[model samples]
Target: MPGIGPSIAAHLDEIFKTGKSRHFEAVMKGLPKAMFDLMEIPGIGAKRAYRLTKELKIGSVAELEKAVKEGRIAKLEGFGEESQAEILKSIEDTKAKSKEKRHLLPYAEDIAHEIIEWMKREKLVARVDPLGSLRRKASTVGDIDLSAATKNPAKVIEHFTKYPNKKRVLEKGTRTASITLPSGVQVDLMVETPDAYGALLQHFTGSKHHNIALRNYALKKGLSLSDYGIKKKGTEDYLKFKDEESFYRFIGMDYIPPELREDTGEIEAAIDHKLPKLVELEDIKADLQIHSSFDIETSHDLGESSMEEIIQKASNLGYEYIAFTEHNPSRSKHNDQQIIDILKRKREVVDKINYELQNRSAHLRETSARHSEKIDQINYSLINMNKKNIQKARPQATGALATVGRVFNSLEIDIMPDGRLPVPEDGMKTLDFALISIHGSFRLSKDKMTERVLKAFDHPKVKIFAHPTGRKLGHREGVELDWPKIFDFCKKNNKWLEINADPMRLDLPDVLVREAVKLGVKLTLGTDSHHKDSMENMNYGVSVARRGWAGKDNIVNTRSLVEFLELLKG
Candidate 1:
C-alpha cells in the first residue's frame, strides 16, 4: 500500500465496480481489433495473429481464407502447407461451432464438482447436492446450481464468498449466494434446513417442463409443492422429507433418478412401478478398450504403462477381464509383419501371466484346506480333554496376490476412408477382438460416412465400434450419419458399440446410447485410456450410460468372462 499510485488505485476501483478491468481495454487500444479477433481462430495464437496482421496485412478471417486458398499463407516464414490447411480447417470449424449452443459436459461437471467438494469441507455444511442440468448429466450445461443443507447459513455464505477460484461475488446473503468462476461461468448456491433439503433439491434439480408437470399432478392430488415442502390444498402445514426416496414415495410413486426426471414419460413409468433399473458404475465388470506401451508409435498415442500394469490395475478394481486394444500398427511407424510379430509376443506374455495367476489361486485353495484340517484337529483335542484353557490355532492370511482376471489381446484398428480394415485378415485372426474406429477424414458427406461405417461393420472380424461419433468436445463436430440405421445394423450383426470414456470424447453420447439400447444392441464401456491412471475414467462412461437409461442387461462388459466370451462368439 505504501507504493500505491493513483492510476493503479483507480484501476482496482474500476474493476471492483464493473467486474472487468478498464486498464486492459486502455492497453489494447494501441492494437487493431482485428488482430484480437483473429486470435479466436483455432490454430492462430496471439503471436501468429499479430504476424498475419503486421506482415501479411491480413486483418480479417475472410482475407486470411483468401490468402490460404491462393497459397499465400504457405509462403509465410513460420507457416507451411500443413499449417495453412489446418488453419483453413480451424476457420471452418469455428464458424460451425458458433451456431451451436451449450458448453461441453465434462468442463461444466469439473467446475461444479470443484465447488461442491469445497463446500462439503466446510464444518457448517451438512450436505451439498449439485442441481439442475448437471445433476441430470446433460451433454452440456447452461449454468451450475447447487443446494446445501446447513443450519449455519451465515457461515456457509461467508465460506462461499472466500472461495479461492472466485473471480467476483455477485451477491451474498444468509440463505443464497452467487459467484462467477474464473472460467466466466456463474454458479448459484442455496442453503436450506435439513428437514426441507430433499424437497429443495427436487424443486431446483428439474427441467422447467418437468417441474410444471409435477406441479399440475400435485394440484390434482389436492397438494401444493414448494422448495420448502409439500402442503395440503387448504393448510400451511408442510410435509418435509430428508431424502428423495421418501419424498417420491409419499407422492404415491417410486423414486425417480435425476437422469430420468425429464418429463419424458418417466413420471408415468414411476407411478406404474415400471421404471428400468438403470446401469450403475458398479455394474461394469470389464474395460474392453484400453491402450498400453505395447502399442506402436504416434505422437498422440503415448501410453504410460505396460500391459501387465494395466492388468494389475484392472484386477485391483475387481474387474474379471480387460482388453488391451492398442492402436493398430498400420497407423504407426512399423511394418505390417513387424507389428503382427509384436502382437503375437504380447499375446504370449499375457497368456503366461494368466497361467501364473491360475496356479497361484490353486495354491491358495490348497493352503486354505490344510489350515482348515489342522484347526479341526486342534478343536477335537480340546473337546476330548474338556479343557477351558485351550489355545485356538488361527489360520494364516494370504499375501496380496494379483487377482485372476483374464487379459485379452486386441487392436484399435482404423476404419479406412473406403471402409476396409487397415490390418490384414491374417493379422486380425491372431487378435482376440478388433475395435474399429474412424480417426480422420471427418468432413465426409453424411451418406458417405454412414455407408463407410456400414461397410466397416461388414467385416466379420470387426467386433466393436470405438467412439462411434468421432466428436472432440469443444473442438470438432462428429461426422454426420444415420444413427438409427447404424444402431439397427449393430443389433442385427451381433456387434457392439463403445461408450468411449475419454473426458474429451464421450462419443456414442447419451442420446445415441438410448436409441442403441432400444434397438437391443449391446454396448461396451471403455476408458480409451492411454496412461495407467486414466483407466479410472470408466465412471464417466457409466454416467453417460445412466443418462441414456441403459441397464445392466444392455452392457456387454457387465457379464462375466465366460458370458462375455460367449457374447463375442456371436
Candidate 2:
C-alpha cells in the first residue's frame, strides 16, 4: 500500500494503537478539505460527523466542544443514548481556548464611500479619506473608520446619527460617533486636521499581523509606529514620511493591494505586484435553461401542453425564443398524432397572423376605405411614412399580439389506454427549438440510469437533457448518476444541459452548473412549465444560471432561433 501523508498516517497509527478505528480514511475522502480537518480527531467519523453537524449543529471544533459540553451528541442518528453523556464528559476532558471577537470589519468601504461622498457634498470635509483595515482590503471587515479634515466633527457625527436606516448608536462624542446601519454595518467618524489624516488612517488600517511584522522589521531598524507618527525609538523626531506609500517604503515593504491586506503573504507578493485578477458577475451573459408550466402534470389546469402560452410568457420575460419542450412523447400518454395535429393548427395560426401582418398595407387600405375622409387621410399618412418604421412597428406589435393569441389558444388531449400515441410533429420547423426530458423510472442505479439518459441524448431530436438529476426539493433525492461523467459526455457531444427553473427543482445546482461550464457544456434555461402561468419560472432558472456564473456565450437558449437549430443539429 502507498504511504499516506504524515497527518493521516499519524492518525491511523493513533487509532490502531487505541483500538478505535473503522473506515477513517474512507470517511475523510468524502468530506470537504475544511470539513475533513474537523473530522480527523478521535471519535469523529461519518456517523459522528453527521450527528454532530446535523443534529447538534456542531460545525467547527468550537461548536463540537459546545455539543459535547451540552451532551447533545447522543440525540444524533447512529449514536447510542449512553454515548451522549460520555461525549460531553470527554469534551470537558479536553483543553482548548475559545477566542471570541467580531469576525471582520463590516461595510468598511460602503461607509467610507458614503461618508466621503457626504463630506464632499456638505463641504465640511476639506479632504476626506478612507483608511484602516478597509483600505488594506481585508476579506472580513468589522467597522468603518473615516478620517476627514474638518474643524468640527460635530456636524458629521450629527449627520450620521440622523442618517436614514441607522440601527444602533454605539458611541457618541463631540468629534466622533460610532453607529450601526440597519444592515449591521458599523462606522466610526473621526474628525482631524489635514496634516494628521494620513497618520490616523495608517494607524486605523493596521492589520495586527501586518503591524506586528512591520513593527518587528521597524524595531530591527531602530523605529516604532504610533498614532502620532513613525518615530525612531532613540530619537523623539518623526520619520518625516509624506504619505502612506512613503511610510511603507521607509519600512522596506511595497504598497499592498487593499484586497490582499490580510497579511497572508500578500505583503511579500505586493513587492512583485502579483495579484490575481478575480472575475466578477459582470463577466457573465445569458442564462441557459428554464421552464414554464409546460410539463403536463405541472400544468394540471388543462392536462395539455400550452405552447402559445409558453411563447407569450417567454416574450414577457424578454426572451426572443424559448424551447417548447413538453414531456417526451415516450413518457406522456397523450396521443402523438393529436399533438402533431395541434402543432399543425398552431403553425396555421402563426401563419395566419404572419400573413395578416405581412399584407397589412393592403389590409389597412381596405379597412381605411370604410372610414371617413379624416381616417383615410390618417391612414394614408401612416402608410406613406417610412417602410423601415412600418416594418419595425408591424413586427413588434404583431409579435406581441401573436404571443397573446397563442396564450389564449387552448387544445385538449386524452391519452388512450395503450399509452402509445404519436405526438404531433409539426413539419413546419420554423420554430426549430425543442428540449427532451425523462419523466419515469427515476429509482435506478447509476450505470443503468446513466445509460437510460444516454439513449435520450443519442436521439438527434433531443437538444438538451432536462433536469438531469431529477431531484425534487423536500421530496425525493432523485437518482444519483455521476454528474461529472454526464456533463463530460454532453460537452463532447455538444448537448446543452437544462437548469430546470422550478424553485423546487433547480435541478442543476449552481456548483454543478459551474463545473459544467468549466467543461464547456452548453446550458439551456427552461421553465419546464406545463401551463402558461408556471412559465414565470424562466426567471428562476435565470437566477440559478447567474448563480452558476453562467454568461451569455455559455447559454444555448440565448442564441437566435437559427443558431439554436444549428446547435441542435450537432
TM-score for all models, in order of appearance: 0.76, 0.41
Question: Model 1, 1-570: lDDT tens per residue?
Answer: 888799888888988999878678877877766686677678799889988898889856667887899999899998999999999999778645532446766787889889989998899999998898888877677767889998888999889878999765656777888776666577889989887898999989997778888888888999888888899888989999887887888888899899888787778888899998999888888998888887466424756798778877887777878888888775456667776676677777767877887787688777778888889898888879897867667665423333635778788888889898767666777888788899988988999999999998888878899999999887888889988889888988998999998878888888888888878989999999987788888888988898778999999999988999899898
Candidate 2 ranges beyond 4 A from true positions: 1-313, 328-433, 530-539
| Best model number under TM-score | 1
Clash totals in order: 0, 44
| lDDT digits (tens) for residues 70-103 of candidate 2 | 6566656666667766555554443211111122
Worst 10 residues of 2 by lDDT: 405-414
- The lDDT per prediction is 0.82, 0.55
Off by over 4 Å in 1: 1-110, 298-300, 331-335, 368-404
In angstroms, how far off is 365's CA in candidate 1?
3.9
Determine the backbone clash count of candidate 1: 0
Candidate 2 structure, TM-score to reference: 0.41
